[model samples]
Target: MTATVLTIAGSDSGGGAGIQADLKTVSALGAYGASVITAITAQNTRAVTAVHPVPPEVIAAQVAAVLDDIEVHAIKIGMLGGPALVDCVAEAIAGFAGAVVLDPVMVAKSGDVLLPDDAVDALARRLVPRATLLTPNLPEAARLLRDEAAGDGAAMQDQGHRLRALGAGAVLMKGGHGGGPTCTDWLVTDQGAQPFTAPRIATANTHGTGCSLSSAIAAGLAQGMALADAVGRAHLWLHGAIRAADGMRIGQGHGPVHHFHELWA
Candidate 1:
């Protein structure tokens, strides 16, 4: 059977991030993509001008409508705008039997805050525990752990442990934000901590990288790949996308990665 992955995220007019990036990554990686738009943003590669959050009821309805009929193999969640929507999503996917990959998106590439200040607690208490995989970059990991000083490798591992304490089945500590010659992502599970490393690609076209990576991992999981293998494949794909990003000149400001690079090549 063909794999199906659902993405619950906001819409990015720029098409570099959020639901747009998620769907593109899913399809490019050979999985069926479905979406539930939790919010709408008037954004571009330069900056986010406005945000209009979808009503909580509407968000719930969208999720229920999709799960009722589709046999989704994995669910990738991003940018639940506020506390109510977070609660709504948490309740809706309470009994989901498939893999759940949560990208705790706090800030956009333009530094716009996608998640509300009040919603952080709700996200931690309600959604983090339900996630099969929690993908957080350095800043996000610090925020989730409530440790503004968590940056070193040791601290990152501790943050992973803290997230597992919060109940995630596994944690992928993204190292892109960590300033180093080599980008190393640490995957912490009940079994142990494993590190995946790749050379850092220098480019400004990294706008939708976080969203794309989580969604790609979800696609791999939906296709029945093991957790470590899924993350490894996602890392390789994202690295390639970043490397190809400079060619796509989608916008004047921070551009998007070439999601269809594999196809174009």
Candidate 2:
């Protein structure tokens, strides 16, 4: 039987990020993909012009419907637009036995804010605790920590430890915004901290990196890979996607990473 991974996120009409990216990444990584859309965005590679959030009840219903019928092995969550939806999702996934990878998607690549300010507290309190792994980029980690600390090596380690205290099984602090030749990701768990580094690929086509990475990790976990190994494999796959992105000219602005780069060529 194929492993099934569920993605709870928003929808991007341009198919770059959110639900579209999550599903694509899951499929590319050889996992069955399922989705529960929390919101819809009129967005392309250029900008997010508008957002339409799914009602809280509707979001809850979708979660219930999927969980009741399917035997999901892992779940990837992103972009809860409001507090109500956050609460709803938290309640729905309270007892899931499988791994849950939460990507706290606060801002978009275009500098547009995807999460509401008021919803941050709810996400921190309700959803963070339920996540098996929490993946936050530099800015999102800073916001979660509520500190203006620099993204230095020591600071990143401290941030990962602090975030791990918020009830997640582990925390992966991404170093994409650290402004260096190499991007380093720190993974902190009960055992110890593990850092994964890769040479930075300079490109404008990084629109859906966060979504893709989290979903890829979920796919790995669904296939029964250990947390550290799952993260390691996801890092490698995401790096390849970033490198392959230069070949595709999808939009006028920042384009998306090629999720199926391995299969295509």
Q: In candidate 2, residue 31 scores what lDDT?
A: 97
After superposition, the stretches of candidate 2 with alpha carbons farther than 4 Å from their true spots are none
TM accuracy, model 2: 0.98
lDDT of each: 0.93, 0.93
RMSD (Å) of each candidate, 1 decimal: 0.9, 0.8
Which digits, one per residue and each the tens of the lDDT, describe model 2 over residues 1-265?
A: 7899999999999999999999999999999998999999999998999999999889988998999999999999999999999999998888789999999999999999988778888899999989899999988988887887446877888888888899988999898888889999999899878899999999999999999999999999999999999999999999999999989889999899999999996
Per-model TM-score on C-alpha atoms: 0.98, 0.98
Residues 1-265 of candidate 1 have per-residue lDDT tens digits of 9899999999999999999999999999999999999999999999999999999989989989999989999999999989999999998888799999999999999999888778888888998999999999988888887787356777778888889999899999998888878988899999988998899988989999999999999999999999999999999999989999999999988899999989995
Worst 10 residues of 1 by lDDT: 147-156
Q: Candidate 2 lDDT (Cα, whole model)?
A: 0.93
